[model samples]
Target: MSVETMTLQEMKFYTGTNPRPEDYEAYWELALVEVASSKTTMEIVPSNLQFSGVQCSELIFSGTDGARIHAKYLRPVTKGKVPVVFLFHGYSGNSGDWCEKLAWIQQGFAVVAMDCRGQAGMSEDKGGVKGTTYSGHIVRGLLDCPNKLLFRQIFLDTAMLVKTVAELTEIDSYRMSVCGGSQGGALALVCAALSPAIKRAVVQYPFLSDYKRIWDLDCRGSAYEELNYFFRSFDPRHEKEEEFFSRLGYIDIQFLMPRVQADILWGIGLRDEACPASSQFAAYNRLCAHKKMVIYPDFGHEVLPGFMDEGMLFLSGVKDS
Candidate 1:
């Protein structure tokens, strides 16, 4: 079946909610403009990883000062520049865990999933970037120095994964895409906007955008909890607040949303308290290229109700896949 475009009103009706005030949309637009104007430095280098043949193989990428980021790549039997999908993991999840979710043998796409720094429960995998976190890692020190946010390094690590995958002999450099759920979802949006190599994006239950709204709502997960703590501890007044959020503007979905030129498929749950529907819509509405959002009213946080068919259909049209 061909992908169908749905209007924002239809989305609200189907999902059973009214449109938020226009001011919310304005906030997203303003933040995005600043993010587009700011410059971020990214560096990529080759490294190694270990994966089990069934679904995973280890790969690594180097960040600033040779900090290594770990990754797992799953390749189909087909050879010669196959379409590629770079998968990013959510908060506290690892690369090995996403191998099954992103495996592409069935769809003829090459999949590479990367582990974010500092997450636990990893097996004897080598060369993965070590993440640093302690009690209250997420919100710890966020209010004072947004520049030192963990996501900054995570974004850099994700970019390095893309660059490494592009160099692999069996993957197509030009036809690559990035995808993930929640944290991964946010990263996918950033990669599509920042990297010229990305041609498609699949974001599911995305987190990290509409930061102020999310902070007010009090969502679950470290991403939100961290912000809550940061605000409680560090007090930013006027311009300081803007500078803190402005640094975040570099990675915020709204800021990155407009720069992304690829086709985008977004999955959202109306009842999703974790990421919230409004925040997800804020990002989807600002997308400049062809885009579609699949809303599941009865579902929250998980993609369901024809999501399987939709994913297949969306990826099928990606010329290289």
Candidate 2:
């Protein structure tokens, strides 16, 4: 019933985390270099949608293999440099899912929420960045080429969104932040780490941080089904883990943590049985940026109403005095 009831320790168990921070950091840095090297500019044109008091637009951006990616831009009615916040959805979700929770318009911030490629509730006609790799199925894709991993395209899409947001007329290029929950939270972490423009980030029960521990724990969400599928299909020896870790190094939050310069507000749900506390802790500890954490004893996976209010209050007044 209260925010205090939620705790991070319980959430860690529900999520999963065992690997050391050093391993995570080393792996992600390699991934960042690879991602940076492969990035290319693609055209993003405005769309036809329009909202009252806001300009609604869309973009056709470059993605894995030239697959067209779609994104929605929400701009303040007034012409000025407004702070920006980009919202990303969890697995099986899209930008439309977070319409009600957007605080950018009300808080005087421009918001752009993007749909991850190959997710549920997305336009089937529109191509996915790579392919669908849910939590339960993470391990299955390790064998694929690094470029083929779903997270790679998702991360690239996030970077593109940030780049695009900076170019928008209504947004201030210097003031940007990213926020999301679960898979979205993980993406927020990745984006915050890679993008220099983000001023702050608030992540809730983030996923894909510590890979080995989570796969072994076999947590609650269908996202982990990917891991189970991978193990059953291939008896990966030590060589496989070594190679997989090498590839995952680019995308994991640990390596990205040191790169993040923005202030952070991280939330951990005690009942989070999917993205565990240890992994979350791994990311938090590696953060070189100014950061703080909120533990919810009773909540799990989603950020509760109370935590949201607190996070907003913190975000509104987050500037250094």
Candidate 3:
């Protein structure tokens, strides 16, 4: 079959080219401690959008560096605690409409969809990095310490969401799950890795993996266009290419896959140009936990057929009869 990336056979073995920082594990450990120490305050205000058998609220909470994160929370009005699902959005996108999240709520699962900080959402991003925030989030803290990497704080935001939700009286923390595509997909994996409470994760064609490989393929548009912008703006001569990509490794999802304990459901499209199949496999290959991958030979970065239904089934933990 014709391929936009590596051949399917090569993809399975692709371990990624992004250099993992030497203190990767330690860096995240300290970040988690910061998240733990933050004085997080949550405010859930009732939303005007009302649906039968479901209660909706606008959730706001403080994240690392005092960023006010926003999410739409929806729960079934039932008495007992129920499963919760965390939903993330694609690059430069928000949590999305309330209607799209109702499916999970209808399935007896409470849903929290996060609007990434400083994106096309209500989440506040207190930008104080040393370099440019002009093009992309990946390059935000490149000129400064790795701890200032935007994704580091974003990943912690997701973990803080999990921790907060787990503490909710109406949530069955043990049954928690997360799902998303592209940038959101990467965050889903990060959330699962950071929070042991996540029982399942569904990610599709995740971005932010195998960065050097993406540069090799020259497929850095769309979600990864920021990589091009960063280099051109900051390191036009490619003099510090290795240094920049290596710093990005600190946020690379492939390096964090091993820490994820949840059963993962990954969808990969072989023809994907936005997020190459090999890049997705780079992270998938490292997962040691129970996992399943659904391959789409002809599909690109677009939706995989029946994946939504499949994901719902996975999150619901119910087999189709």
Lowest lDDT 10-residue stretch of candidate 1: 13-22
The predicted structure with the larger lDDT, 1 or 3, is 3
Any runs in candidate 2 off by more than 4 Å, and if so which? 1-50, 121-137, 236-246, 318-321
The residue-by-residue lDDT of candidate 3 on 219-293, one tens digit each, is 767767888988889889999988888899999999999999999988888888888888899999999889989
TM-score of each: 0.73, 0.79, 0.95
Q: For candidate 2, lDDT tens digit of each residue in 186-292?
A: 88888887788788887788877767656555552466666555645674454465566556655566656778888888888656667766667767777778988
Candidate with top TM-score is: 3
Error of 2 at 280 (Å): 1.0
Q: Write the per-residue lDDT of candidate 1 for residues 137-206, one digit (tens) a residue.
A: 3443355554455555555555556666776767778889877888888888877765657888877888
Q: Which model, 1 or 3, shows the larger TM-score?
A: 3
Supply the TM-score for candidate 2: 0.79
Ranking the candidates on TM-score from highest down gives 3, 2, 1
| Candidate 2: C-alpha RMSD after superposition | 4.8
Identify the candidate with maximal lDDT: 3
**Which one wins by lDDT: 2 or 3?**
3
